[model samples]
Target chain A: MASMANQGAPERRPGIPGTPGGQPRGRGLSMRTRQLFWVWGFLALPVLFYGVIRFYPTLNAFWLSLTDWDLMSEPEFIGIDNYTRMFSDPEFWKVFRNTFTYLIVGTPISLVLSFLIAFALDRIRFGHTFLRALYFLPYITTASAMAWVWRWFYQPAPIGFINDLLGRVGIPQMAFLNSTTWALPSIMVTAIWAGLGFQIIIFMAGLRAIPTTYYEAARIDGLGEASILRRITLPLLKPTTVFLVVFSSIGFLRIFDQVYNMTTNDPGGPLGSTKPLVLMIYQTAFSSYEMGYAAAQTVVLFTILLCVSLLQLWLLRER
Target chain B: MRTQILMAGLLAGTSLVAGTAAQAVEIEYWQYVYETRVTAMDQLIDAFEAANPDITVKQVTFPYADYQTRVVAANMARKGPDVLQMFYGWTDQFVGGKVIQPLSPEVFPHDEIEAEFFPIVTAMKRGDDYYGLPTAVRSLALFYNKDLMTKAGLDPENPPKTLDEMVAAAKAMTEMDAGGNLSTAGMTLDMGGQDHQWWREVLVRQFGGEPYSADYSQVTYNDAAGAAALKFYTDLQLVEKVGQRGFMDEGQAAFRAGRAGLTIDGTFRLGSFSSIEDFEWGVTELPANAEGVRSNYASYFANGIGIGAEGEELAAAEKFLAYISSPEAMKIWLDVVGELPARRDVALTEENLADPIYAPFLKGLDYAKTTLFIDEAAQRQNAIDMANRILIDGQSVEESLAQAAEAEQAIIDKAK
Candidate 1:
């Protein structure tokens, strides 16, 4: 790059006006060349890794989505046949709805739940670290293990903790993951719980970034708690909210582990009520061995992710 | 001088070891994760290696759920196992994709496969070649809780013999709490697992029809017989209300826990049932419908060599497979895994047939349906949806079954 800059036109700088040996251009050029060489040398491995494992596959997925390969044969270009199949399939639409249900409902519920916990935790001085660590535990736990624990929690009375509690309180037995109406919401609760710790930590960090003087200032001005939060704290927390909204929205959009693990017996079950797009993609690619179709669904998922993230950032953007 | 001689002998021994190491052929054998399976595989590999010092078998496993995915990915990278255990239904897709090898006559002769293995296991045959060979076979039977039956005032000795009798027994046995919810379910009908087999194999056959055409090109389970079959299952849940799925989270678990009076499950449950000392249970033939017919669904895991394998690796895989199908290996598999032998000679041995536990599964083999669907995943999902629609959505039996049949036909049509 330094050589390219030199090739275009040699820069004849003023050389710091009165400076004698202001690092002569040739020596400086070679020095810059040496730094760039080492910088790229350090970067080359990761660059090649991303090219082979990440970027190449991603780019190939775009092209593969237009073909009709089963991964065992030569990919024959079908010119949007895969996309047509995906759009026309009823299973795709069901998965699309289920995915949006997770994103639209899961994101707001998780953000608010985590934020409230974080806010309450930030106010507590005693056992604050212990409590925060307790809340952050799920974040580090393996998702499959956490999902199975929640699955046990959702079981019927005498076995499941949740139903047992409900039964003791004299409520009718509710089908947690069995009913079509309840399965998606049930999966969402586990997903939100699994992701809550990380969200709370992030929210706490955002909470700490706000200056305490502002709260003290609002108190002096006789602002109520709600008023102080609305006028001073929330506005300052706009950047954090935007970041979380986008981050959590993407998480919900690409949800697979929770749905896959929670309903391990028949994942995305009770008539496809809990079948998200990612699970559907996994089924198509691995179970059905339809590479082209899976790639097409991946493209659809990518487009949805792009639009959703952009819309979230725009909606949460500060004026 | 004595120390020099000893050193020279040690050097010669080291050279011999080096020569053996250089000539040994190591072949990977992929199996699904299971305690008994691992033990059985270790025993087989040990025996094979001891018999053939020139070959080595490396055993590896993945979880059953991800086994197919891992195999496909490894095969895609041209580093799949030299030999792998493939589910019977997956053989067509595997061979169609050429991810696994088709056994040549020299590798596995057709007559030998037919003569050695049970006639039913020959379902693995596609066209003229065999894709895999199973060391063991599994068939479904009705697992009943004798204690539950006795508590419900039903005779523990006499189990349900007909569909009507089973319903009567189940309804008689259902125990409800003061809150009016079922406490002990008379039976369990799970959409995710056994419901499909009941609909496709048991009930449909009792109603006098096959689930699919002989060519596997069409769905034949949509006629009056199919509707009647589905209605019988749905009626057991919705109309009779004898069984509630919510009573147990898993399909066969209710019966295993002794909460279910009767549950139709495969022979593989024998291994899981061995630990249930709390309950008195036994297997019986599945009940016939109004027409007095019987049927069962049997599926097996067959080990085969995969693609991109050549030279000594292929030879080693073939050698291991031959050893695996031998009666000695079959005996070890049966003893360790509680599975029936795939080979006719091994399975029909007087001692094996006389074993009390193997009797029911072996009896089922006479009337079991083994389907080799290419798009088995889609078919399974369709069946689950059918169960959900009739049981949960309150859809009519005709409407749901017809819809499921259409969906199944669509999948079959799309399959190559």
Candidate 2:
């Protein structure tokens, strides 16, 4: 083992070509050039992959958004007619509002619930790992499966668990996932629940990273638990909060699977009340075969994501 | 080394010669993955291969939801099927996208196809060319649970024959829990499913309205007749309170679970419904309105030769298409997939007409209308949204019908 380790160490050593303190084999290349060659050689695969797969398609979408391509005929240059049409389309505005509703209602509820659970979990010693794992189960489960289960829960009496429970307790049956007013919120609740596990795990990690000495110092100063949480804990957890806010905000904005699966028959349905922008884009592209219009919708989504993320980063800057 | 090289060359030469001696053409066939349809196709392929031993056919399937997208993507990649099955409603999109080539006149004679196949098969026609053919066609019918009807004190043998009778039966069969939540829905009201078709093709015409103009270029279901049709549908839930939407999450689910007294579904449901253990269900023609005006909706999935096929593959696909639409293959499709044979003679045979399960759907073909949908999904969603407006948003029937008409007209105009 010792001899093997010794052999591996010298070979891995940077910029020293063959043998320890040996003369350079040739004056053909400098140390920096050789180092850069190795660096780029390793990065070449990923760089090429992103260039072809990600960057090319992204640029193509921008060009496509300006044209009218129906995936059959040649794309005709339309000079922002798609943008004009999208702005005037009432469906697009409904989807826009729905997407914002998911972001606004879903993010804070998930974050606060996760933080509260994580904070309490971090302070406990008994079966902490098991409870954390329990909370994290939904995170690892497939979103479609989770959405279907929630869909079953939202069914009417004799089939739906929630409605059955309500009936048992003498409460009127709620028309969840059926009522236009309730469908979005019902789906939002599932999205929030599906996302809670990941957020909780992240919050726990952030909680663990906080120095225990600060708490000890606060205890010595006879600080209340709430004050210690507000003054020391929250302010210290700012970085994690900012990251989660941006991450989850992006997630909520681009929500699709739960909404699609829960309303499989009529996705974004109950009069398009539950439709997010992504689903609308999907329907436009695949269902209607309006590729250019879908591309325009994609451009709008990308812009929204950019602005929202930037706003969050600016708002949560280290001040 | 010299000896080994000589031996390798000799082997390669012999194999190349052997390959040229007996050439076999292989073609790929693509369809949506329905269990019975796939099974029936496999059986037909086996029979076809036995007769034409030189041609090999491969079957590929995608889920129904993703079938069109997959086919389009595959065609774009130059790896699409030689023969493809497509919904009759998608003929326009498929033709526009060049997913399929028009059937050659020499192989599929236009006169023979028009005469032998049902008139509804003409939906595949564009311009002067026919692009596809179907082995089987489907039409809607009333599916009733016998047990539920008997329990409701209605005669199980005699299902509803008139619109008023159907509503009365639905009201009688409906059972509510102590909490006033529906325990058993008298009828399934799924606007997203076959209900949209029922409303557009059946109810609208029965209520004295033409859903579309003769050329199918304009929407005409926004008048008083259309509003009355829309009102009757919504009244099943709002006023009559015979059923609830999303009761068992889906209309088919409620019917299958024996929690629904009646459901309006296509003949494609026959195989699934027949498989239910110990369940007694019956099929009947959709109820006629006052003055005995009867209307129904007919649809089918047709097989087409993909644009990707060329030379030997094209010949093979043409042969396979002919074989699948032949009388023998249509019979197998009827037995296995439970869809009515596309050929009028094949479907209207005494044996098929005598079968209680298929008779109602077969009879429906006489009065059924095949909607020339340019964009079936979008147009169906318009109907669904129109229903939601009345049922969910409490919008007036006239307003909802007008909105639906406008939306449908826009779809038609865009397609044009």
Candidate 3:
């Protein structure tokens, strides 16, 4: 039938019936080609967007790290000088330590807290949906607004709620944002709280995936509650925990908005005690307009993020 | 006959539009958004446009935190506003980068500007060129809670006159619980927020040292005088325990809420202070040094014309600048917004000089200074670190001051 149609229009070049490109016609589409068509049709838009918006600038930043650009005049190529200067700079090292502090401390505390909440939430039957939504509220709130509210809570007596409650309990005032030692941890508590909602929802979904029969069987076998949690619940929760560990680890690594908003008076202040790598990059790029130096800092942040996420995944993998 | 009438109407309309275009020129004015400032600026623009029908002024405002960055980005794209409002400290960077053009010498002769404005304008001038002009200037003054002073059994009418008396007053003003936590602060030390500004601009000079050279070459605040200044300020908390760092929002909120005895803040604070009706507050000059030498911080935001504008656009911007700096605009801004007039004649009137609320700020104008640097933020951060080193770690003020000088000197060097 295809040959008869081609003979009817003999002047026409040999080609697929519907496609614009001239080629020999086929009776049916191959499975791989059809699959690719659907996959690429969906991927093309995001691929174009990432290439234009994300990938190009990322590549440009790699090139810019080797140059001197102040965002005003044309960039000047200066070899490895920016990196050399950054390595020797004391401020850079301080910022590096601060960034890691967020990652190492923030990730585990947030994960454990979210898991506990989700664990308790999954078993509850009365008002379960309301409780779940309440836990998820902070995840949807704007980060800066949340930081400002947390800042108010950290205030001293007569102003800060935490201090007022402490004073009522006969406890002495504990400096929060003011003291260098306490500022980072105080901020971390807020960050973890803000992210707890999303993690809880994911964890609940993971908990729900476990078959009820497993728990019933264990119950019949005379297992205690703690044993069931340790043996079956935790083991099944490994995947959810791993996903959150990597996601929240990256979130903590690039923490900026909270520290920036909280420390607006002197951003990353109280001796730059709370200054993260991202905040430093922001200051370098926007405040000082040292685009080249900022790019170098950004490159360091990228590597740290990449390495930390990979390490967490490797360590958390099933053995 | 009908076609002729249509052609005639079209020609008339075209000429009328062309004539209006030929007569008027437009210039864009950029400022950081403050509610009062935005409102005041709009009023000024409206008045200026009305006065000069041939010129039209457009206003643009950005949030305070991102204004400078926005201006820089706009200029980089060659879309900068014709007129830009920037801080006194930012003048150095703008001048160094040639981001803004100097005031037209024909319109603003050097002598006219010097005679018109206060002595602070001299610092604003680079060599012979005047980079910009302030519509209003702000200086720090002591704002005290009258109710708190009365409770402390001190006279609110008579503020401290000297350093020792200031400390004595603060000590008396403080109230503590049995466990030794402060129930009421005598005064909040600038603390980590903006303590650096107070240190470099006010105390350094009072302690007999210049924070930085007039030429912007070196820092002298690391010497003996600097340590003495830092110790004197920090001693309020460390030795006297008048106010500690643990309090939240201690500076503005503490004073306003009647929990603090005193605070030193900019004249711009008047807008917020005016809203409080429960307690009466008074403004006075900050206490002098033990030697009776007084100084204050006078910071101002000035308007400058950005680069790339020429011909009618630049001329139009100059016209707007001249209008804003005029006595009328200055008075309107001072009344609506709360800074003292930059024009010496306007601020020194008998009515203004006698007004108790604004007079103390006006008195400080003679000895006030702005900390000039390429990047005031970076230099200020150095000051913050120096302060934190002493307050948090119990480090010697002498060592911290020394470290700050080296760090700040490097920042200035990099800007060059």
Candidate 4:
């Protein structure tokens, strides 16, 4: 019957008369099925994975903020108590202050230095890759090794490299990591050194992406190099700038590994100067085993991070 | 949207069937001893299996650095190690929360064993209730390079009898090359060893000051004796300039390479140094701070054995522990492993105490003092760390001790 119908299309497939009327509709249905398969297959796995690993945990953590659970027993619902205690925690404010201090002082300095280097590299004629790799080498180096090297450099003794260099120029030995006053600043220096590489790379990429015609147009208009950078480069690199700014804020806010490793988790050590917030949460959770309290701390940290990210998006996000 | 619906339906369907499934009784055990020690632990499992085969012991060893964090995370997950090793400093945190199983003399019968072992061995316990058992015991003893002492005109047989004599002899024995680098130093302090507290606390005790008060309510070291002790230690670095920072400058290398005269450390490192043959070394008692006061805290590297509350392999776990601590088995541990015995009777044998190398360490145990088995051990350690930093880092002795006192008081108050 199918062969006869194909051969002649006789009487609109009389054996199954309604099928002819539904042919275009059936083809449309199959097309929709194919579209759904591709769309769901490509997109669903990532969404599910993200939901379970990141989003669910974050949401559960926030929900956990309203309860008391020590990971042993059933969670007790104690609404707003954890949040309430956070308001009065002196250590919270101190840690928050330390993080802000690091971001405020360290980030801008690193960004500016990286920008200058990138600008210079863009203008250089010879050994550009070598110089770029040289500038970027420290970033690629392992954090533990770099931290140790920086520690040796910041050693509080006459034998310290920095101190010895200073002595050559008639300056006395300074306790870079040992003094309460100098320890935070010393860490900031390390942070700036490590961060500058990535910033330079990002800025260079943005610079490269900018059309040469913009510079040519500016030159025809008799604009200087500095003015062109400010007018053409800076304004056009909004996306990159916002990207760096938001990412760096998140990085600085969650700066626990450096603070913990560098300071050996000594609270108020060398005068309680390098105590950052995330470090406090770690000390509370693992070192002290105050999970419920640590959970409380984590919720506050999340809130702070979330608000900052949202504000940055609001301020710098393109329409 | 269809995928989400399908996933939701599948999950709901699974939940309905999950209500009828049997839950596995999970038991977790965490230890720091890895490699052969883990294999040695299996002998206990065999014995446990023979007794009551229902329970299973899932043993794991974490790296030293991550052990604490892993345990904490496990606890947070509501599935922490049913039995875990708590160090000297960390014991109090467990006891403070009452999170650990209490081994009373009634429950585990450690009364005779406790008396036989050094009093300080149970320093982490509270009364008759102990959170764990002493798996390894350690104490500080003088380790002298016999060749260096003899070459420097000091009798190798007769080590320093007094602090003054030690200082004088160290000064005499110390030699410097023409270039003025430390070619051979007379003595250096072991500041980072597990047993360092024994020597440091003993020295402080000699000056007539206890680290914590009799009540455990105050840190009493901020006063005159504490100041004197602090000054004396700092003088070794500042005024005398005799000793090097043992932690920063590797003491083992100094000893093996024949650059050091005298070093003091625990018996545990004896295993690590058993193969060092370049120099002849002898062990002796640590120098007394006073003429006679034996005021050292005993340092022990211990592992606890306990049955999981609802573990499937409870019988197996207990049997494994018994097998490991047996006389024959523990002898293998003591002789081959070279760790000092947690059992006094096993320790006194010809292989352990009678040997020339091990005899002097045995003798030093006579003068040893142990820490009080209190709940606030870690807090005491924090206070001690402050005191150590002050003395070693050239901070004011009085101020450091005072800060330590303040810190100790706060911790004590919280514990109470």
Candidate 5:
């Protein structure tokens, strides 16, 4: 059936100069063929780019995960050894837990915070755009700069803003970034805050996309504000919520910049308390130069990202 | 036509200029960016360029954190600098990664390098080849604030000469606020910085435990002496309460802000500390243990020719490396960067030894041990983790020491 339709396409397009039924098709390419030619011509560069730049390295990483390549000598095949080593390593497990902690705690907190802000800002007429821009400002700022600023805010009295405030209230000084227990959460707070701007902007756009008519109809049906939000606004915003759930989940899972910049001297430190998988991968690959081990970590992270994203999409899918 | 003749003459002029420019060999040199070091390097480059007109040197720098990664990436891409600066502890990794090549004996004879430079420079030697050379070397010393010492009712000029004396001075200087939090740290305790080095090479040895075997193939700092060293370090904060981890963010910062009475730092801090106005700081030898045993960690960043260079570029890099390691360059580096010269003849002079600020650091080099690190970052992280385990996680010193030893041993094994 598809072939029959394709065969009829050239005949149906008689107005096109190069169509078989309209002109001498032997001298020039058929209209359909030309269209395909143009499409492929435009696609060739990106295809070649992804092939060499992205896909090749990605596939090579999978191969490298099975071999021992220390970025110096020729890679030697050592199948499953990297994976076994990663599994047995206690540090890897610590980093694994840290990575998930970011995803589990960071995603929901950031989403809810951004949603609340967006919802509140949506109703306000005065300074709405200004407020939106203010929230979005952090997203545009450099991650390292933001992380450093947050680091300063966590410093002890006379230096850190938070500590000075706490000190004024006769409260004991808190070790925000320095404490092993507090360091991960402290870094997570920064990561979530850094991502809040982007999430808020996205949520606002999603809210705006929810037609006013849905809310109006719901109100006409005697729905309260809360009821309307629960039924009409939220149901209509499923697509946006799904996208953000996956996006923010992936972001939290791959959190690196904030943690790294915050703990620049000893990244993933205070005893590897805040290390995410990506940071671990970076340290293994760059610091330790254990390419195979790092590659295995990367593969694990890639699998987690894939599973988490898929699971989120499935859970949030419209029934 | 007249236009054709003019065009031809213009083309000839451009070619002639290009020909002349091509005669001058240009080589790039890379180092991590520290203000004084960069300035000193620029000065050396200027002098070197003046001396060798045919060779042009371009100085490139990256932030210290990103410098190693950049060098590795550049090496992998085959676009590395002609000469690159690297930490002495990175010698093994750099040699294994082939990021740097050994100096040719014809240009930098091993006998001369061994005889002229400080004995510690042998850290760069692998087998019979010397992979790099340093213009200046660094050793840990006790940096004390004179005003803070005076305020604590201690003699400002006579810094602590013994561990017990240092602890006493620290306790005297420590000040608590109304909330019982440290308002001023008597001593800055930063495990993430030079404290790790001090704990490994200085404290461990001073306590009678070698950090690593003589061949550097085994971990040996997990014994009783190692635990004692670890206890002494942590006790400075935990028991005596003279210092706090993460005080004023970093030990150097606390000392810089005059909130810290003393900090164990390397000679590299000399330039930065000297620049602080109204800050009366003094440098003294690291305090000896009760047995009067003293040990220190001496380290340096050495200049090496990248493996990427060949032929003319390689030759130029060799000459540049030679020039940078020369006595003249070492003197300039010492004066400008405040690091002790790498050569005994240049740095061990009566003037340098008698100079109050440099004397302690110079004296430290006499018994200083430079740990041959397999992976400096990982090994440093082990030390940092050991300290954190005791300080933060409240782990036992013996347990932490054992864990650190095992971790370091694994790293050495993996490198093998």
Candidate 6:
């Protein structure tokens, strides 16, 4: 995607200066340039839209962080006050830890499960398209409703779906969402469930993109399926792996909706055990009406994401 | 031919735009009442529209929980309603920043009925400036299962007179199964998060301590009286074991189901629990801790019309306000809505106060008080945290009160 953007940049035409033959070629070249200009103009609308709508807000957020601005009052410039308060605020630290836990626990579980499903689906010969769509159904639903459904599913009593299932098997009912010790893990489990469908589809595309000739060539060498997968398939899927890992990590870092909606009994309920960084920022900004502090927290979140993305790129680069 | 075709298309497009353009002055009113009073709102809007002939009133109904956050967001986005329905706790914050316009008591002409409202209604007005008119009132009261008290060898007619007697009766009334596990509880000590702030405030006042002082100027919850209040509330669940510890809504559900002895709630819940046919229930004053300190917290909301902060549609908005607040209009509003009226003359009606279900609330309103603190959300949230800590975490009363006072004072300091 990045390379495609570079290719679209306009370059000056060469090989035409002062010769009589060059004049005819230059006229033809000018006609093509006019055509190219229209194409570029069409593409510029979306590019400019993304720059203004997405990038400008992010830049404004950074500037807003340095000032104490209620949406109503004139902003008073206060350097680092919000950041300093955030450092000392116990609630921020709790939410940060919760978000990190979701990342560490949720990302790997999703990655492994998705890859396994992708590998199996790729090997199946019958109804592969139907099965792929079935597996991908969850990712297509806008997430809030799905998150709410998961919340009811994780209710802290025997009435909860999972608890009822466990109960029918003669196991004791569990307080999945109510107990502080289990709340984050319970939320993470539902998150991984909501998350796995998308990752599987991404990995399946990566698997299908690899040509069968490489596998055929390996089969003739008497290599087993496991050996072929380990040696051939894994080596060729580096770009997809990089994409999934980076995207999944960012998703985990900003896991707000599941935690926010699922545990509403306390607002930041269940002893604030399931509150994430994004939720904390939202509450501070809107509920507490502290826009400056929320802006500062947004900056911190941005820094964390930027650092994580850069680190992943460095770590997963081709050797 | 091409010019004729283009001219035909232009004429049609211009007519379509002109036909669809709106003509009336649009004002939005956001509220929490639904199902119970939507018919009343529609009627009120109909009457207002008929009276004004120029203004259009649009009613936006949201679930009760979503109102504050939605209003705040819309206001920040510069798309807020011209008029809003505000809870008792929200009035101070709205008035503090001058985000809302004040209706002059002089300009408001409903045959000059200012003297007809309770003194508590005047609390809605900040010195020399009134933001809006009072629309409805709610007060907390003690709701008890009469059959259970009788079955436990207690007099069904005699309710507890003081806080100490209330605890003893609860201890005596609590029932357990053979396994010694708690099968039924006597009372719950305001166990829920956030919503229990009103209960905590009433407890503070019952002990002769105010959460904030009378002038709404100072927070006084961490003092000796505050500690006594906290200890009394926590002791019901922790030390006495007469009430359940952590399960708030679950326990309240149980009480509603006739499995518990007592629950403290507001007058609004009468409509919800009116269908319970198994157990005979009755309402009485929420027990006071100190004798002669009969104060209880009032929970009411103000719904009135206001001009947009841009100050454009004052005449149309004021006309609508006047139309809705008339005595005949208030009757239609209250009967369909089930909210107790804010006007003293309307509330004193034989039809409203005559209901036996309203007995406890009317008694509670005798000493009823509204929290006068600014930064109402912060004060409410801190009080909730303090109550939860005392009941669930078993913290000392002094510690809980100290933490609550500190949290609230910080919010107060921030505004300054």
List residue ranges in candidate 2 displaced over 4 A: A1-27, B1-22
Best by TM-score: 2
Candidate 1, B255-278: lDDT as tens digits? 777778888888788888878998
Q: Candidate 3's residue-wise lDDT over A105-206, tens digit each?
A: 999899889999999998889999999999999999999999999999988776788988888888988788888899999999999999999999999999
Candidate 5, residues B1-416, lDDT tens digits: the string is: 99999999999999999997989999999999999899999999999999999999999999987888888878888888899999988888889889999999999988999899878999999999999999999999999999989888899999999999999999999998877888899999998889999988888888888888998999999899999999999999999999988888899989998999999999878767877676688989999988999988899999999998999999999999999999999899988888899999999999999999899999999888888888888888888888889998899999989988998999899878
**lDDT per residue, candidate 3, B1-416, as tens digits?**
99999999999999999999998898889999999999999999989988889998889899988988888888778898899898878887677655788898998888899888987876568878898999999888888888888888999898888778878888999988765678789987765444567778778888998888877688878888888889988788889888866454647877778788888888888888899998988989877987889988788889888986689998888888898989999999988897889999999999998999989989988788766767877877787778778888889988888888998998888876
* Reference contacts reproduced by model 1: 0.49
TM-score of each: 0.90, 0.95, 0.91, 0.78, 0.91, 0.81
Clash pairs detected, candidate 2: none
* DockQ values of all predictions: 0.42, 0.68, 0.50, 0.11, 0.48, 0.15
**Per-candidate clash tally:** 0, 0, 0, 11, 0, 0
Global lDDT scores for all candidate models: 0.84, 0.91, 0.85, 0.66, 0.89, 0.73
Query: Which stretches in model 3 have alpha-carbon errors above 4 Å?
Result: A1-43, A215-231, A316-319, B1-15, B192-194
Cα displacement (Å) at residue A58, model 4: 2.6
Model 5 DockQ, alpha carbons vs. true complex: 0.48
Query: What TM-scores does chain A show, candidate by candidate in order?
Result: 0.88, 0.92, 0.87, 0.85, 0.91, 0.86
- Please write out the lDDT profile of model 4 over residues B282-383, one tens digit for every residue: 877777654666554556655543323434344333444444445656666665556666677777777666787666666666566655333333453564
| Tens-place lDDT digits, model 5, residues A1-319 | 4345446656655556654465344235765686665567678999999999999999999999999988777789998999998999998999999998998898999989999999999999999889989988999899999999999999877678998888889988899888999999999988888899998888889999987888888888898988888878888878988999999998988899999999987898888899999999998888788888899998999899899988887898778
Q: What global local distance difference test value does model 2 have?
A: 0.91
| Top-down TM-score ranking | 2, 3, 5, 1, 6, 4
Judge candidate 4 against the unseen true structure and give its global Cα lDDT, from 0 to 1.
0.66
Positional deviation of residue B172's Cα in model 6 after best superposition, in angstroms: 7.3
**lDDT of model 6 at position A63:** 86
